[model samples]
Structures are given as C-alpha cells and as structure tokens.
Target: MPAADWRMARFAPHRTAVSSAQVETVVARAVGIFGLVFAAQTVPVALEQSEALAVGAGTTLMALLYGGVVALAVASIGKVAVTGTAAAFAVLYAAALAAWPLLVDDPAALGGPPWLYYLANVATSAAAIAFPLAASVAYTVLVPAWYGVLRATAPGGQADTLLATLDALYAMILGFVVLIIITMLRQASRAVDGAQDAALRRYDVAARQHANEIERVRIDALVHDSVLTTLLSAAAAETPEEQRLAARMARDAVRRLDEAGASGPRTVESVGLTVLVRRIRAALTTFAAPFTVRVVNAAGVELTVEAIEAVYSATVQAMVNSLQHADEAGRTTRRELRVRGVGTGGVVVEVADNGRGFALQDVPNERLGLRVSIEERMAGAGGTAVVTSWPGEGTTVTIAWPAGVDGATT
Candidate 1:
C-alpha cells in the first residue's frame, strides 16, 4: 500500500463519515434533552394536583422522577451516567403509577388526566434507552396498558372506556417508535465498530508484509553488491597489494553488514523517542497474536539515528524471540512490552514473556539471534541489551541506550 493509504487505514475511519458510536451519542443526547422538555411540561400539572395527594409521597415521587431526568440530561454530554439515570427514571415512573391511588386523598377531586399521564411516554422512552430489547418492548406495552386501566378508574378522572383505550394505543405507538429507533441505531453502531476493527487488523498485516519485503530487498542488494564483489576480488588477487586491498574490502563489507543489522537504511539524523514509540506500537499491531503493551514517559527523550535503529531492531527481535520460543505444553503464555524514558535523555524498552524459558548459558554458539542480532547490534550502536531467562519461568530482554539508570516501568 502507498504511505498515504496505509496511514488512512491506520486510523481506520468509518466509511459513512460518521461512526456508530457518534450516532449512538447523538441519540442518547437527543433522548436525554427531549426528556427534560417532557419533565418541564409535567411540573405545572404536578403542582396543581399536589393538594389532592399525600404531601410526602407526592413530593418524594416528583423529586426522584425530576432528579433522575436532570441526571439523564447532564449525562447526555457523555456516557458516564446515562444508563443508570435512564433506568432509575423508568422504574421510578412505574412506582409512581402503582402508588397513585393510595397517595391520592380523593380520586374524585382530580379534574384532568393527572400529572402521571404527562410522564407516561417519558418513562417508557427511558426504558427503551436503558433496558434490553425484550424488557424495553414489555415496558413500551405494559406502561400504556397500566395507564389505560388507571385512566378508566375513579382516580384517573373516570374517562370513558373507548377514550382510555385510544390514549393507551397512542402512548404505545410513540413508545414503540422510540424503542425501534434506539435499537436500530445501536445495532448499526455496533456494526460500524466491528468494521473499523477488522480494517485496522488487515492494515497491520499488510504493513508488516511490506516492511518484511523491504528488508529482504535490502539484504539481497548487500549480498550481491558488497559480499559477492569482495569474494570475486579475493579470488582474482595475485600480488601482495591486490591481496591486501581484497582483505580491506572484506573488512569493509563486514562492517557494512553489521551496520545493516544494527538499524534500518542509514541516516545521520536524530528523532524524539515519541516517534520511535509510535513505530514500535504500530509494529506490535501487525502480529496475529496478542500481548500487553505499556509505555511510560517515553516522549521527551532524544536519540541519534544509530541508537534509534539499535533500540528498535533489538526490541522487535526480543518480541519475535518471545513469540517463537515462549510457549509450554498445555499452558498459555503471557507477553508484554514496556517502553519508558530514563534519567536525563536515555530510553529503555523491555520485552517480557511468561513461558517455558531456557537457561541463557545453554544457548549454542551457532544461534546468533541473541548474541549477534540483538546484543552485538546494540553494542555497535553504543547501547546495551540485557537478556534474562531461566527454565520454567520466562524471558525478559531489556534494551537501553546511553546505558541505564533504570527508568520508570508501566
């Protein structure tokens, strides 16, 4: 992939230009804000009927219901308290309905539909937002049916049976509409979230493959232009001067090879640790397996090109080593990467895994992965790598530059 496209995939924006989470937030806020309006409309009716109901019961019911509405409205700005407040109001409204008869001193004194009628939709709407689909559906149906029953009774102003049934149908229709909209929005948002996650995973894999191909090309070029040329020059050497020159060429090739192993394509520039941290994080995402990552105060440190190359290469190698070797029969391994800034301007990266480890001393000389790729690579760039491992415990590779005074760990 082109750099631009890869970067676009890295962030994984939704295709519709609006994320599902954002849509859900908008819905929540809309419901919450509209709930406030409904609560405001009920205040006058509540005040008018206060004398007909028990003082304490009516006061407590109104206070809790209004308080829950206020909380829902405040939480509309974020997700923190929306569900809790919404659920509370849904139940509180139902309680107020059930107690309406007992609280009222005389049902005959009530002159209109009653303050509870104004809030019927509000409660069901809250339930739609907070409860599961089945529960919300039930609330949508039952709240209206209960209200219709109350409306047909003496306390509900003794309305005609047909009129009460119409009122119940109207409330149910509105409640179901709200419930359907919320459920659909939630389902759509969840789908968007899943797509973004899958897109990011694919991007990670593609990026890693691209990086590996680039490294392969670099190695092939070095073998053809540097290593092979040195070999041909040595074979053709006849005189002392020719032999000495071939030997010098061979030495130069080895140094170049070491430099190649130590870092990426050569550069004399420096970069902040923050950029290095980002690269490491991006690299980690490419792995099909999972691992915990912790970064602490790694932003401010400055590193020369050589040091950055060494640290990055060694850190990545450490993780690769863990992936390849950290496993046990019938046991799951846990791996972690921690990057942090140390005293003054130094940086440290630690890769650890709890797996079936081997004694460091048992590693054979032919296996240069640890000795050459990581340890010597760091040393060539004026850094250090300390690898610790023991049988049955785990392995930890700590790579540090400007060699350490231990830094903070996350």
Candidate 2:
C-alpha cells in the first residue's frame, strides 16, 4: 500500500484487533487527517470567491491553496516516520504562503476584506500543530490576530472590525479543538501502556516465586527420605543385619549431602515412572522390613522433572515411615508399594504396611516427616498426599496427582 494509505490505516480503532500502541497511533492519525481534510474545503472557496487570483499575479496566488492542500494530503501519512520529507514540505509551504501576498496587486496597499483569510487559516490548522505545544498555541492565537489586523485595517472593511475579530477568533477556536482532543488521547494512551508494562513485571516475579517454593519443597522431602530416614533406621536397628543396613543408609546420606553441598542445585529433568519406582523398590531390599513392589498400567508413564522428583521423594519418605514405625516387636512386617493408573491420565501411589498404626489426628505436627516430606510437598506440586491409619490396622499413605491438574505426569 502507499505510504499515505498506510499512515491513515494506522488509525483503525478496534482494540482487540490491534495492539495498544497501534490503537493510540491510529487515533492520533485520524485527528491529523481530519484537520487536513477540513482545510482542503478552502481551495474551492478561493476559486469561486476571490479576485486576488485574477489580478496580475493572481494565478500564482491561487496556487497557494492548491500547494497547501497537496502538502497536507501527503502529511496525512501519519504513522510512518518521514522526518526529511515533512521538513522539506514545511519549508516549501511557508515560503509559498508568505510569497502569496507579495505577488498580489499593490502589495503595500491597505487590506480589504482580508484576502485569503479562511484559506490561510485552514492550511495553518493542518500544519501549525506539527510544532511544539507552546509554538502551536502561539500560532493558533496569532493566525486569528493576523486575520483581524488585515481585515480591520482595510479601508473598505474598516467598519466591520467586530466581524473581522470574530472571524479570526472562530478560526482559532476550531484549530485548538483538534489540538485539545488529540493531546488528551495521547496522554491516556501513555498511561495505559505504562500500566501494561507494570502488570507484566508483576507476573514475572510471581512465576519466579512459584518456582523457588517448589524447589524448597523438593529439598525438604529429600532430607526426610535420605538423611532423617537413615538416622531413624540406625536408631531402630537390633540385629547385625539391620545394623549393616543402617550403616548403608548412613553412607548414602553422607554421599547425598556431600554431593548436594559440592554441587549447586541440579536442574530438574524428566524420569520414566516405571524406572523410578523400580529403583526405589531395589533400594528397599537393604531395610530389615520387606516391601513388595507392584506396577499396574504405569509402564511408559512420563512426568516433569519437578513432578517426578517430588513424588519420588515423598513416596520414599512414606515407605521409610512404615519400616521405622509400623512393625510390632514380634510381628512380620509385610509392606507393599503399588503404583497404578487411577483416573483419566492420572496415577495413584500407595505405601502400605501391616503393622501397628496410630490414629491420624494423634500424629503431632512436630513430625515434619509426614507433613512436610509428603503432604506439603505433594501440595506444592499441585498434588495431594493422604495419610490414613488406625490403632490396629496398618498405615496407608496415598499420593496422587489427578487428571487435568497443571504439570501432571502424562
């Protein structure tokens, strides 16, 4: 498309259709283009009513209205940056407007009927606002003053001083109306743009905060699953076999802590669900209590790094809780870790043991092992952890990430 059409097109006002920046630019362009079109009306008026263009140099005088119209028409390409073209046009227009009267009959003779007054003011209305606000204000006022002086001083128009002054004032008011409306719109657009930028900054801060919280939950669960679990297992050990298992737990805890401290946080990465569960089941063999692992339709399941880590840590913590707390002194500890698909694109994991169990409400908050390591950790990752236990029946801890939840394992 032509530059002029492109500039005018910028003013299309559909807010949903265009960006905020474009919406404001289009509004500004509309105002400028309207002023230019309003001024063009004077071209025909000059042709029908003015004798100044029929005098010795009248044809050239006639060309001022025509040239000014052309300049304003080109200037309506408002959206594009056209600094050089506009500057050249402004210079040529001023020179042409100023020379119009010099070529008229008896240039120094007393003014009569204020020749070309409306035509000149209309052209000024179109171009004068390209200046700074203060300059435009001065011109909007001065153009009328020039018209008043020219007409009021004319011997033939001397008796119509009041009419000449009113005419000048009328033209000035019309020009300022355009300036005022556009000024308000530009200020409003800037305010809206500023608000949009602020909202985006807040959103970024929130996203970062959410990520940090998830990281904290994962680390807390890891400590419960590894370091704390090892200490408790060492405390519960009676047989030499149990003692050896405790020693291994200590070694694993030491290595975990050493590696964690030596290296900064590792980036979260995807893990296969079946592979993760199998690893956990293999690790459980070292414990005094035996655990049976079952995978039901959970093969080939994939989950996000954070989801997998959170679930893995919490599940391990649950199994540790059972080994350390569930078994009675003279009873066989039979434990099961089951992972199964429970809903549409969802999974349910349970750590169950047949041993002495306590009431869920009786468990104190001081036990961060269950609250933070499992429940709170799951919640942070948009999942749930439920601990159900009675005085006699075994404790069952279920962790689930339901279908349609954000960041769910798929």
Candidate 3:
C-alpha cells in the first residue's frame, strides 16, 4: 500500500471508552452520594431512638463523628478529597459502632433494634470503597459479627441468637455486593486503559515510519529533477549567456543538495569544545524560559563533529522537553544546563529541572522526545544519554559523548 494512503486511513472514535482513573473518580463520587442518602435515612431512626442514647456525652460524640462523615461525603461529591474521605468514613463508623453499647442509657429500654443497625451497611460500604480487598473483606465480616455479638448480649438488648445471626448475614451480604461492583468496575477500567495505551504506542511507531518515508521520497525527487536538469543544461550550453545560466542553475542545485544532506549522517571529524558550547549558547537564547548555564574546564577538549552535533541536538531536545513539561503547581521550577570536559577527550552535557517529574517507565513508548530525539540520537553518535526522574522530586537528563567517560563537575 502507498504510504500516503495508509497515513490517511481513518481511525474509529472511542465513544464508549473510559480509563481506570476516570472510573475511580466516578465511583468515589457515587459512593459519596450513597453515604449522604444513607445518612438521611438514619436520621429519622436516630430521633426515634433518642431515649436509648445517654443524653449529653453519647449524643454529642455521635453528632461530632457523624458530622465529620457528612462533611467528608460532601467533599467527595465535589471531588476534593476522595481516598482520605473514604478512609475517614470507614474509621469513624467503626468508632461509632464500638461506642454504641457504652453510649446507651439502658439496654432493657431498647425494645427494638438500635438506630446504628440501619447504618451498618453504610459503614461496610465505605470500607469496601476505601480499603484493599483483604482489609475490606475482613472489616465486612468482623463488623457484622461484632454487631451480632452485641445483639445477643445484655448491653445490646439481649436479642435471640437467630435474630442476631440474620442481622449479621444481611449486612454482610450487602457489603459483599458493594465490594463486587467496585472491584469489577476498577478491573474493567484498568483493562481499557491498558488497551488504549498499547494502541497509541503502535500508532506512534507507524506515524514516525511514514514521516521518514515521505522525507526519503522528497529527497529522491530533488536529486532526480534539480540535479539532473542542471547537469543536462550545462552539457547542452553553446553560447556565453547559456553557459552563465547553466552555471547559476548548477550553484542553485548544489545549495539545494547541501540543504537536503543537513539532516543526514556525517563522517567523524574533530571540533573544538568551545565551538559546540557556543552553538548551544546561541540555541538557548531562542527558548522563552531561562536556564542557569554552567561550564567548566572545556577550553582545549576536542571531540568528533558527529559526536558534537549529537550532544548539541540532544541537549537542545532535553531543554525543549523541560520547557514543555517541567511545571509544578504553586511553585517556581528551576532549570539548569551544565557542560564540562571529562578526561582528555570526552565531554558531558546535562539538563536538570527542579519541577514536577514523572516515572520514566510510565512515559508512553511513543514519546519520541526521549526515546528517539535524545536517547537514540546520542546512541547513534556513539554517546550515551541517561534520564533520571521521580514524580514531584524533579528530572535530570545527562548526556555523555564517546560512550563511557564521565567528568561531571558539581
């Protein structure tokens, strides 16, 4: 198939696609709404059973803890604090359950089930959303069992064994249902995210290949039409005017050819370190963001022109990447460029940024700025590039020529 036709092929839109991060966010909001609704339902029961609770201390503590849960739920709905909110709900609900027996004025006066019983499902649901599978499952079983034990004891109105068992089972079942739903949604969303990332990586490789092919075709056409025409005109010239025209066309063709070869591979030739540094300094001025430059002991050092160009290009690409991505919220980022001579013949260039960084492995394979432009370019020129970064800490890109030498000055 023709490269142009393949490149033109349409890709289907992902109308129904969703990522794990997005699914998690939606689930968190839904759980928040669920908690709020359950809170409302528990209110009427609390009022009906107010006589059962010890007036001042018990009621005040309940209000304080439950109010905190309600605030967390509201924050979740607004997408402010999700993970922390889920955790707080689970912990606070457990505290309330443990304090239930002590808070009651008289267990015998509690003729019916406690109002807290109605919110058992709410507590377990919060646990399911907040904790890991093992912890959530344990909480589901333990909390219900504890409730059942309380029901069969004097402090919990001394209910029959069968009644307590039934109550525990019901709450456990509801908790399990919520756990299953959330687990399945997260698993499916992760699968979708993985598939989308793979697809994008494949597309990136194909697009790069297509661009190379197009450039090759353009260079081939230039050689054939312009170069061939100039040669033919020079051979056919008979008069001084014709000769001058042929000469002018020949010079124009040579200039065009030189432009074409500008991006091609070059033979190794020695160049002074000062020349490379000067070129980089000139390029740095073009960037809008400023970089702190440091140079040390690089006066007399010499390296192959191919290596010099590779290091220069890689350094520029690194600086460009920092400018594009190294941003931290609520803080200013510090960027630096360092160049120094190592050993007698080696050179090193480094670009560092104290900005919001990212895990190297997490970067998509198709991101040519690192994989192709910097790393691959350096490798092709017989040099090495190492990228080090951590999320939030910062990023540093170190480039070294002649492969294995490092004489980096602090």
Candidate 4:
C-alpha cells in the first residue's frame, strides 16, 4: 500500500469509532472460533496417546495456554495487549511442534494421534492470520516451512507423512487468506478517501452560495433603507421645496445604481440610514422619465437586511412597470412612486400613474415582471403586494413588509 493509504487505514477507526468497534467484535469472534477448534482436537488426541502420556499431556498443556491467550484477546478486543498475547501463543505453538518428536517416541504403534499435530497446525495458522501484517507473514511462512522440512527429514512414525502434508496445505491456505485480507483493506481505504473528498467539495459549494446570498441581502438593504426610503418620503412631502430636494436625491441614487451595475449586494459592518437614503435618492433621479420615486416617513426607522432588500426590489419594479406602460397621450410626464415607512416595523410603497391601466384580472401570467419583481420580493420578506387601479384611473402598485423578519439587526 502507498504511504497515504496505510496512514488512513491505521487511523480509520478514529474517524468512525462505531464501525471500528464492530470490526473489532468480528475479529474477536473469529479468534474464539479458532480456539474452540483447537480445544476439541487436542482433548481427543490426548486420550488416544497412552504410551506417550507425557507428550500428550505436554501438547494438551500447550493447547490450553494458547487457548487462554485467544480468550484474553477476544475479551479485551482492540487492545495492544491482545497483539502481545497472540504473539506469545504463536511462539509457544511453534516450539511445541518442534519438540513433538522428542516427546512422543513411537506414535504409529499407539495409533499415533496425528490429529494433535493437525490441531496444533490449525491453531498456529489462525494465530498467524490474526496477527498484524509483518508479524503474521513471518509466523505463517517461517514456522510451517521449518516444521515441514524437519518432519520430512526425520519421520517419527507412519503418520508423519500425513502430518507433513497437512502442515504444508495449512501454510499455503493461511498465506492466501492473509493476502486476500490485505487486498480488501487497501480497497476499503481508497473508498473512504474518495468519500471524504466528495464531502469537502459539497461543503465548498454550499459555502459559496451562502456568501452570495448574504451579499445580495446587504446591497438590497442599503438601497431600500437609504435611496428608496428617501424617494418615498419626498413624494409625500407637503412642500414643493421638499419634493424638489427628494427628486434630486432620487436622481443621484439612480445614477449610482447604474454605475454600480449588477455586481451583486455586499454586506457592510455599519450603515447610517440617513446617509444611505441620500445616496440612493441621488442615484434614482438619473433614470429616464415616467419612473418617478418619492420617499415618505423614512426619518427614524431601523430595519433588518432582508426587509430592506425586499422594499428596494419592489419599489424598483413598480417604477419600471410605470415607465413601460405609461400613456404618452395623457401627458403623464412622470409616474407617481411612493415609498412609505409605516408603524415601528413596516413599510408601504406604491407606484401609480394617471395613464391608461390594464385590467388586473386580465393580466397574463407570463408577465411575471411585476409578479416576481414586486410581489415575490415582498412575499419573501413576509409581506404582501396590493394592486388597485381602473382602466381610466390608472394603476397603483403597493408593496408592504414587516421589519425584522429576516434576522436581527446589529
């Protein structure tokens, strides 16, 4: 495995602890099953070897010792101590196999229990399979090869040939199983790395979208609170002088908006309502005729970002609508655009004209300029759009929204 793959495999349990625990449980169960197999074979073989009772006893003792180690490994599950204990068991089993001939002089005459050797071989093979990489390979390969050669060279009895053949088969099978396990672990490691990479990409996309939305809200708020508010306030002014001043402010606002283009909204740390309104009004005045704007009651009100954007968009749409549908025959040089801040937490903006107006009921659904631009903007801010007009009396488009619906203002 590559270094990166190895590192990820080593630390995978930390990322998902529950999955790690489950894997440990599975390994423990496998170890326990191997121990049971060893015990069943060893106990029966011990009874059959009467002439070599000492050898049988010694083999039984070795089996019991290794069996205890396997039990401890399963009981602890995933501890470093399990590895140490398994290593010790592997050493003892290998030593017992090496000394088997000396312990049992003539096994064929006494129906030489080759089952004991087979049991020992299987137990040791399982230990090799369970141990970590380098260690598992070392034990599985070296011990079996050494025993096969020694037994072939000095056969103790008639059953020695059968024992040697079984040992060789066990060694080959164990080696193959280990290779398969390592291959599976490598594949699992790659899969985990791919999943993590995909997750990171999704997070990046979400973060960008969130940032864009925040910026849009900020710009909308600045335009509504400052420019649109001033335009609406000036429309309702009782004096000609106040009206003229408001008109100039609105003109300047339009100019600025055109220059800013659609760079999208930007969030600001702090904004003064009065100053922002002045800039907006100035920008609006620069737009063409039939697009009049008036700001009313904008003096002493505070608003959240979302509400401000809602009002700005609605007012802009209303002005655009008037400019588009205004009748030139009636000499309605400018449309009446009124934006009013009502109560402590709401705003009402109306755009009307003295020109010919269409029937509201007959308006086509495809004409969503007004629907999406005006109605949808307010609706998003938890507000509504009210339209009241006749064929002769012209049209009045009003948008209202409650303040503080978006989020807390700082």
Question: In terms of TM-score, how similar is model 3 to the real structure?
Answer: 0.60
The local lDDT score (0 to 100) that residue 108 gets in candidate 3 is: 72
Q: Which residue pairs collide, candidate 3?
A: none
Alpha-carbon lDDT, every model: 0.79, 0.61, 0.78, 0.58
Tens-place lDDT digits, model 4, residues 1-410: 45476446434432321222233445545565666666665665555554554546555755565466555456545444554565566666677667666666555544543334554444454464357666666666777666665555432344366786676667657655754564465456445544543543453354346547665666687698768877787878779888888888888888767655545433221111222244345446866773555665654444444555566667777767777776768465447766665654556666788777878888898989877887766665566777776776788877666623222121
Point out where model 3 deviates above 4 Å.
1-16, 108-111, 234-410
Q: What is the full ranking by TM-score, best candidate first? A: 1, 3, 2, 4
lDDT of 1 by residue, 1-410 (tens): 77697556445532332355466568778878888898898898887777778767668878888888888878866566677878888998898898788888877667787788877887888898789899999999998999999889888878999999999999999998988888888888667656644554464455557656767799899989999999999999999999999999999999989888766533233445755675677688988668798776654466655677678889888888888889888999999998888754688888999999999889999888899989988877677889889999999988888664474221
Candidate 3 weakest lDDT stretch, 10 residues: 7-16
Give the TM-score (vs. native) of candidate 2: 0.41
Worst 10 residues of 4 by lDDT: 267-276
Model 1 poorest 10 in a row by lDDT: 12-21
- The candidates, ranked best first by lDDT, are 1, 3, 2, 4
Off by over 4 Å in 2: 1-24, 49-51, 54-68, 82-100, 106-116, 119-129, 153-159, 211-410
TM-score winner: 1
Superposition error at 378 for model 1 (Å): 18
Better candidate number, 1 or 2, judged by TM-score? 1
Compute the lDDT for candidate 1: 0.79
Give the top-scoring candidate (lDDT).
1
